[model samples]
Target: MKTLQSTTFKAIADDTRLRVVNLFVTSREPLCVCEIVDALRLPQYQVSKHLTILKNAGLIIVEKDGTWGYHYLNENNPLNKMLFTFLKKYLVGEVFDDDIKRLEMRLLLREEGRCVVGFVDEKDLLIKIKEKKQELLVKE
Candidate 1:
């Protein structure tokens, strides 16, 4: 168990991994890889790399829905739950504030509360999101 704890600690040691965990803590729903990419403004490859580490460390679990894979904190794991609760309080301010804000925006683009906007490029997703926001504004 000590080895597992060490691996978990090592997984979250990186700034990006910590930010990802913090994002999960703040989110009301599980987030897909594309949504994570959009929120972080990081390449999918980088996000995937961090996700793999977190998964290997037993910090996260992934679920497949159709073509998209959604990631969530490993709630079933006692250690993960404990760590996530700690993260929820510990990581407040600039450490992950911007990423959380961006995640909120990314979630707004969801269609029927599901992550359907899979973007190969961040710019394309931004354009679609802008159009969707304008449509909502016009409707109001």
Candidate 2:
């Protein structure tokens, strides 16, 4: 018999899930799976697997828009909100810091506050950032 306590803890027991939670903690914007994969430097399937576990545990929620599904931490429950605050305070390290940096870079691809491009690999991300900068300059 898995209670909510056990299920919630179990969902975050894995290192990958912890990382995913950390991303959600840091991000104010909901992210799509591909953005998470690119930020975590992991395969989409691997990230998606952890995402499913988090979803099932009620730690996060997904809002689907057409083919893209944006995910964010679920804080509707008081316990989950408290857990989110705790994780935001405690989950730290070079690895997590790197994920945030990569995620910030990935977020540059968002258009009008939504993810427009999918899976911008690290190399292409740099080029895309440069292009975006040029576009901004042109608009200015």
Measured by TM-score, the strongest candidate is: 2
- Clashing residue pairs in candidate 2, if any? none
Question: Tens digit of lDDT per residue, candidate 2, span 23-122?
Answer: 9998867999999999999998999888998998999999999889899999898998888899898998998999999999999888899988888879
Q: What's each prediction's clash count?
A: 0, 0
Per-residue lDDT tens digits for candidate 1, residues 22-99, read: 889988478899988878878889999999989988888999999899898888988888888888888877858998
For model 1, state the Cα shift of residue 136 in Å: 5.5
Tell me, by lDDT, which candidate is best: 2
lDDT of 2: 0.91
Model 1, which residues run further than 4 Å from truth? 120-127, 133-140
Give lDDT: candidate 1, residue 93.
79
